[model samples]
Target: MANVNDKYAIRMMKADDYEQAFVLWNGLEGLGLSEADSPERIARFLQRNEGLSFVCEYEGSLIGTIMAGHDSRRGFLYHLGVATAHRGQGIAPLLVNEALSALLREGIDKCHLFVMEHNEAGQRFWSANGWEKRDGILLYSRGLESRGLE
Candidate 1:
């Protein structure tokens, strides 16, 4: 693993980054996610909603990624993952800041993300970054498999 400054930089993703981004995406714990994920799904998602994905590159290779989207209700954060070798170096916050900047510029006042209920590390990271837990709102998911999207 390379030093953080020497190895990684964050930037808006390009069309050609889909394959590399997919590799990073597959490594995440939860992201509609699995290591066997197909690039086609990622491509299709980005094509439908461009400017919602960003990648972090290390030594010219994709090592991290974040996906964000918004509706009338609130902005959603997704796929905010850093590669195993790139953890603990403040990369994720940069990616989140980039996404939040875009959303803020678009007039989004409230943004929300879901971490697995058991993920204490995730909770701590978000809290340290100034994200507070919404007191009463529960996140309920309708499984894609139940809807046959799996």
Candidate 2:
């Protein structure tokens, strides 16, 4: 563990960062981690959606991470997390803003992120940041491969 007072920098997440970043996300309670998060898949994601993902480095240790990307018209955010000891110091918003900023630069106007229904902390974070929870909307997804991608 490194001191928060130490030098810190936020930069794009490289492929090599997959292992450590995966560990960090899995350690967090609310994040849904799965085998699909393997390094190969993450690398493919970063390759297609570069510059929208980032990690926070403190004394060479990864202390935070966020992933944002857009599908031409709208942006989506995911896996925004900061270390337990790093909360309440304004790092989370910084990470979210950076990702959102990147998406904005990509010509995306509207953005959305999914928070588990039970993730009160995440809801508060978004709400406090002026994000309104949409009413009567739902997020649905399915595996492309299951539909015949593979």
Among the numbered candidates, top TM-score falls to: 2
Q: Which segments of model 2 are wrong by more than 4 Å?
A: 1-6, 146-150
Could you tell me the TM-score of candidate 1?
A: 0.77
CA-lDDT, candidates in order: 0.75, 0.83
Give the distance in Å from residue 32's predicted Cα in candidate 2 to where it truly belongs.
0.9
The backbone clash count of each candidate, in order, is: 0, 0
Clashing pairs in 1: none
Where does candidate 2 clash, by residue pair?
A: none
Instruction: For residues 1-150, write the lDDT of model 2, one tens digit per residue.
Output: 222344767888778998789888978878887666888888888888999998888778888999887889889998898988778877787788788889989999999998888888888889999999999987777766667656
How large is the C-alpha RMSD of every model relative to the true structure? Answer: 4.4, 3.1
Report how far off residue 34 is in candidate 2 (Å): 2.6
Off by over 4 Å in 1: 1-6, 29-38, 143-150
